[model samples]
Target chain A: MQDNYQQKILGIIGGGQLGRMVIQSAINYNIDIHILDPDENAPCRHICHDFSHGKLTDYDTVYAFGKGCDVITIEIENVNTEALEQLAKEGKKVFPQPEIIRLIQDKREQKQFYKENNIPTADFILTDSKADVLANADFLPAVNKLGKEGYDGRGVQVLKSEEDLDKAFEAPGLLEKLIDFDKEIAVIVSRNEHGELVAFPPVECAFHPTANLVEFLFAPAQISDEIGEEAIKVAKDVIIKLDMIGILAVEMFVTKSGEILVNEIAPRPHNSGHHTIEANFTSQFEQHLRAVMGMPLGNTGLRMPAAMVNLLGEDGFTGDAVVEGMDEAMKEKGIFIHLYGKKITKPFRKMGHVTILEENVEALKAKALKVKDSIKIKA
Target chain B: MQDNYQQKILGIIGGGQLGRMVIQSAINYNIDIHILDPDENAPCRHICHDFSHGKLTDYDTVYAFGKGCDVITIEIENVNTEALEQLAKEGKKVFPQPEIIRLIQDKREQKQFYKENNIPTADFILTDSKADVLANADFLPAVNKLGKEGYDGRGVQVLKSEEDLDKAFEAPGLLEKLIDFDKEIAVIVSRNEHGELVAFPPVECAFHPTANLVEFLFAPAQISDEIGEEAIKVAKDVIIKLDMIGILAVEMFVTKSGEILVNEIAPRPHNSGHHTIEANFTSQFEQHLRAVMGMPLGNTGLRMPAAMVNLLGEDGFTGDAVVEGMDEAMKEKGIFIHLYGKKITKPFRKMGHVTILEENVEALKAKALKVKDSIKIKA
Candidate 1:
């Protein structure tokens, strides 16, 4: 246990908005936070106590950064797991463990783990070679995911016919039949090393079709209690199976037939839970720090209904980012805007987010739409 | 108006908890915050864009700190107002303008302004010398306030008769007839440059008699709606009369007969409204930044009932501060703790605070007591 607050230094792997917010909470506790990100202008630089500009996937970089920290955690999954494994072997506290990251990093391994653990996820076939999937005709009209390095929409393709099968390459991957789903939801759960677990209320997330990025999120999703409970149960089950020790965000699909299928998991604070910062009793960022630091998990209760709108970079403008129509959006009540300190803007890059809270979810959604339309991220 | 976020650098005069929290909110807006305080380890140091260690009371120090900033503000009112006056004269946007700070720095002037503006405050008589107070013996059994440098309890004394009047010193001061008050309450009010005003719900504070420090504070002030409304009205009246920008925390006393009297006011984020950080849609710190930056104020609506317990340094333990029984307090649900990064623990120093939320105000109060009993701040 940490004897002095000054000695409680936490090392974070990524330096994006997640890391930035974690540092925000860490400061409240007087915890020293250090970040390792290749970008010198990472969003977290100004807030963190220390910054080491190095590739998160570089073994030496990750190991050196973790050496002086009391506990090591990640804000992103694509990190040097081997270095984390080495650190854990030396008795350093690495939350979610290097092994868990290895499982979640690969779509094939993640799906196999869910099946082996009897967790309800989408049915999929993992193949060692992509040629097997292309030659076999059974996996038509499927979603093809590269085994590794499959970020947002970059490595996932929808293959509807034999002609579209050419998208597959000679790499290990997974093929899953697409299911008609009514909605997408996520449950952000956290567990400490002592096994105390807590989950925020499930939030429904809407994604942009072309960008494959979350456009908006609504807390306490406008769904039946039964569906919300089922989604939370799936999320809790996944955490327990993986023995996750920090924040585990579980995204799942609610099928038209009332079944919940686990989609993916992020072993850190996720975008879907951003509304908690304004509308919940405990923010996910604060909770994540509590869990990783071996402190008691905070109460996860919604204080009000809330919706989150993403601020994505405009398509035609790229250079230094500028947020337009902020004053106009500020005129609306219950609207809170956050602009990530990113110097450059590219098409579809996440610049910031806006959270709107109201007693009625519908009214909140309406106000959220208005905010989304008024604010534009450009350069 | 600032066309780009990067150019919106905000300079804060005090680097204490209020300044630290303002930076916490300022980061979300991507605004650069620079703080000036004599202590290099000031709480705002780690998170701010820039830090200059210098006495806030020194005119040259404050002026030099404000020279490169677009706007200047304060977390504490003890700074050099002349520097702020010069900054304002040179086209810098100084919130709660230096003229207002000058008026608030002295009790005699503050009360006179209240009288001139028809604001409701305890009746008082301004005196230039200590002998005048003694000459008018009918002002017996009154409260004597030192005109300047009078902190929470240090410079105030109650005299019952001429025998006890010797405590009065030769300085500009005020003597006010003491009233039998039922409770102490405060309302945190905010105003933008455009005259738009917003107020958080009134909060009741319980004080430590010997220390003259707040022990705990309850939001929505467990008072009749009529009394609550009166408190808010007086607060709003004071804010408008001061022509205040940023946040104005009005502390008032409610007499046994249900009459309200403004006691004192602070022109910045205050301890009384700290509960709003967790229980209201907009925190006082965030609201202060928004108002000062010319943004529309956020929704000042309650999300839940909350109580705040102050964590003061334990008596006779004056080394590095150590918080004891934190784990025990964390066992209670809805209890949030904050520790200011003060390296040393002096007796009765304001180290940090804890916020408790519950549907039942009485239950919350009960839990608050338990938490208070369980936690100890020592060296």
Candidate 2:
């Protein structure tokens, strides 16, 4: 088994920071990792065993890259799934499966998946264009989401009233009911080819006021036992239903009346699980590797309560990255800083993250906020 | 401070497993690491930011490597100190200062320094040749050690009696009286240029019956509080006395009568502290980086009891490496395996290590032994 693992060449489709971190874990197994990304200077370029500069969505490029790999995976979800499907047909192992990737590539399909599968989620209406969104003014107070190519905070708009309909996407999209929730939480679940599945404890996310990205996260979310269990069950069910083999991050909203609603899901290691690196028995990166490699899932128990803070570039910086107050943050105990090897900083760009561990959730939150306030990424 | 850290490039003298692990930690800081080693295919070659294929002991190679680095350190102490001394004179920060490296490179000088500083250590006499060792016939049952170029379990022999004298070293070396100790423990301590010092809890080591290298290690060594405290104090004192500005591992013997005697010392991360990667708040690899970077020492508190088992190559095999029973070992919980990227296997070679974490020492020990017995490396 070990010889087979060593001989297997694992190819990752995106050579960003996530791929870089996964390669870091892969090194422990002595597994050769090949990376494909358009950026020649991607963070994973220097560390990966092999690197090919090409478009992740280019059919020929993706097919050629997968030819030499015994098993193929991805750090990002925007890669060409058609090529992966062909590779799968040719006997190469493509984890998370190409069909599932195709289903997740469009918001319309994702929302439809939840509804058809009887998964609890907010009500939504499919829209062909801005005209279709404007036709149904009754769903005025909904979120307009582009069906494809929408990432981060882009291609999303709050259509709270008729006047706001101008913000609706001009392309195919959906109008999802705006959920009034008590909190935003995420649960990461992983499944292996052998049918083994495991879920990391749920974590509550606090979004940046205007950036539309997670700013702080507390593990073992401050939710009721029933809610946490429900979140895990829902997450596990989604993966099992998709029959996907790998890690998935399921984001949800806990409404004020105690209803759990699915918000979004990522079919790979997510920002929500970054704290696992230092606070859990097994890091999510390692768990992803094991799941895809068909190895037994690791113990997902928490070593200690942990809080994670994303280190985003300051609003006004747009040149070579400069980290401020790192010294002060390091002076605090139980603080682990991870800076992505990105040389430049732009407003709200994810430059790195910090994980804070404590004996209790309260202390972890306090330390996490303090660390967030102290460290700044600037030009 | 962060800018200074980012701009600074770290040069390490050895590109083996130790340097590879260090580079793994250094990557988190986005710090550029340049590695120098004789083997072109050294384990650290790919991951490091820069790699130079050259002799570490060659003054020109070492000097040229140091010229591009803002800070110079070593993963192995066999580097040419003269080059480091010159680099230090020219304003490069050479951690574990050249003078201290020189002092530790020879076993004779190490023993003498321990005695001069009133540090508790086994008594020993410097010997220039085999004749000098034979002159003291009454010093039977002593251990003869080569003064220089000795590493791992090499360049040492047991002089149990006149018949064993033939195994004594013939070059400049030392004859040390061996102690009948109840347990062998090691403490890893780190000091920064700012005079800050911190020590990890001592860990007990069990050497292989024939390999002479550590076979298994248990953290928070099952020793009395007094002995543990004494061991820590002795380790800290050695670093302070030497005024070294980097991490050091001090191996000591705990006599049955409760006396603590220093056995030897290593200037870089040692095998005994490998368990810290998963069991302690701060891993030894990261701690070494923090100490040499002049950053504040992190919390070295133990999160739980842990045991580390060194993965050694099986005897009677020498060829392309093949690992056996890894699948069975991964079936167990709380097992973290780290396989160094060495393609070939030789009898007794350090192949990798497994760190086992448990709620209690008894369970940790049981799991560790089971893991040790299950995993095998062969060719």
Candidate 3:
């Protein structure tokens, strides 16, 4: 509970856009941040107090890195849990705890964690391989997900028929019954070690039809206030059960029957809450740092209705990046664009995001699409 | 005016707190920032794309730094104007334009500019030295100001009597008739090359009795709507006459007779607008970059009623710095403290600031004083 990390060096395990954003907020409070990632060209290399290029999964590298820091957190969940556990034992604060991260790293274990905690999640069957999933066809028209190392809509596929099952990869996976949902929503919850919990407004996420990636997100979702409250309550329940000391983003599904089901959870600043940087009283990145640093959690009130669209690299671009139409996109008022400092533009890779804030929901929604259409990330 | 500075290098002279805050906003737009300052330990040294430890007033050093950047801006106005003028001739964009900086760099010329432009400022006479002012005696009970190289309440004195004149330093100065003012207010006006202008609400500023520096500021100045509107109009007129790109903060005095008079102006983000970071829709730091980058100006609406208190270094402490009562101060909701990354804290040095936001003005005023009482910046 002591403010040991105040103005001290805090190490982060991953140096992607999330880490980049956390550094952005940390600098405001004069907190020194060091980032560790496998790539030397990691997006966060520029802003952090120090950056070490080493595999986060390498036990020696993570353990050695943790030894020199007062606190350690992650932007990614694939870090060496054994090293984090060791660091925790050595009096280094590891946020979201290594055990929680260990559980969430694997799709099967994460689903089990939900069931064990009595959390509402979709009915899912854990399988060793595609053959096992094909043999048990009861969960047909389900979503097949990899057990580990999958992110950003990767390592997941919808199995609509036997032909879909045949397209499944030969790896351990989880077969989740795709619920008929009215909407996909997300709520970002921040909690400190003091048990203080704050939840951002529920956001409705619309995914691309084929890519299964969030196309755009709207805060204070178009759903009724009652549904938004229900979604938030569900998310808070999950965070309370997990008892994670950091930001926990709960992605949920609102069924036609009005039941809220947890789709998944990310124990760090999630894409759904990106709009918070511009639309909320306190940004999710700042909230995450506050939680892990044992500082008071800030107000999560929305300042205005905001719509966010992700800028993924165009299908063909694969080298040096060029963001076209940025000048035109920025001409609109209340529009903020954040480009992650990534040099290359690989197809479908997250290059940046644009947030549109407006008092009128319809107007903001229209502006969001126009922004999405105007900008293209290419090589 | 194209957005040529997008994802391009921006060279800023003087890497102090103002430059640091500007860099914080610049990072969001993916613009590369490089800073030139004499202090390698300056607040912006770490955050910028590149930092050159060199004399800002040296023509060769500044010209070299300008050559590598797409556009050059300034946090302090004392940089070599000749270097900037040369860069401008070579086709590099320099905000606030070196010609304007030349005129504002001297108090005598600045007052002359106000008179020439038909700006409503205090009546003043340019003096070659303090001896000239004493010999004339016409502007007794006036304010004596140095022509150049003065900042942060330095190089200015009140000459109330013959005894007060003896305390003045011998230098080329300006003698202005001191007017009895009801309140001191400032408005930050941002304008781009496209002539798009936006003005923040007038903020009332209170100066420290001894330091003569802003101690606290209130946004939307506790005045009637008419007075606030008149103050903003005056500020806009000054900015229009200056015709400078980037932000110009116009300081004004609301006299006892209800007439507003321009006090002075800073061609950069001024301290009185620090509360905008937490209380407004878009921060002044971000607005400055928008103007300099040729992007559309953002909304300048206030998000909440807010009060800001400056954090000057304790009167005695003069070594490495420490901010006491941060935990206690941060415990109060809506109280945001920003500490400049200053290793040493000398007496009356601008160390940082705290912003208190509340819907109720009375409650916020009370909370602001409590925050001011709680935190202490010491060495």
DockQ per candidate, 2 decimals = 0.51, 0.68, 0.45
- Displacement of residue B155 (Cα, Å) in model 1 is 1.3
Q: TM-score of chain A for candidate 2?
A: 0.98
**For model 1, how does the per-residue alpha-carbon lDDT over A95-195 read when each residue is reduced to its tens digit?**
97899999889988999898999888888887656687787647788888889998756778777778887877568888887877899999999999888
On DockQ, the leading prediction is 2
Q: Please, what are the lDDT tens digits per residue for candidate 3 over residues A61-125?
A: 99999898888999998899999999999899999899999989998998998899888899999
| TM-score of model 3's chain A | 0.98
Interface RMSD of each: 2.8, 1.8, 3.4
Fnat computed for model 2: 0.68
Per-residue lDDT value at A111 in model 3: 93
Query: Candidate 3's residue-wise lDDT over B42-77, tens digit each?
Result: 988677788899999999999999999998999998
After superposition, candidate 3 runs with Cα above 4 Å error: A1-5, A224-227, B1-4, B224-226
lDDT tens readout by residue for model 2, B77-132: 89999999999999999998999999999999999999999999988999999899
Q: Which is the better candidate, 2 or 3, if ranked by lDDT?
A: 2
- Candidate 2 vs candidate 3: the TM-score winner is 2
The TM-score leader among the candidates is 2
Candidate 2 scores a C-alpha RMSD against the true structure in Å of 1.4
Ranking by DockQ: 2, 1, 3
- CAPRI verdict on model 2? medium
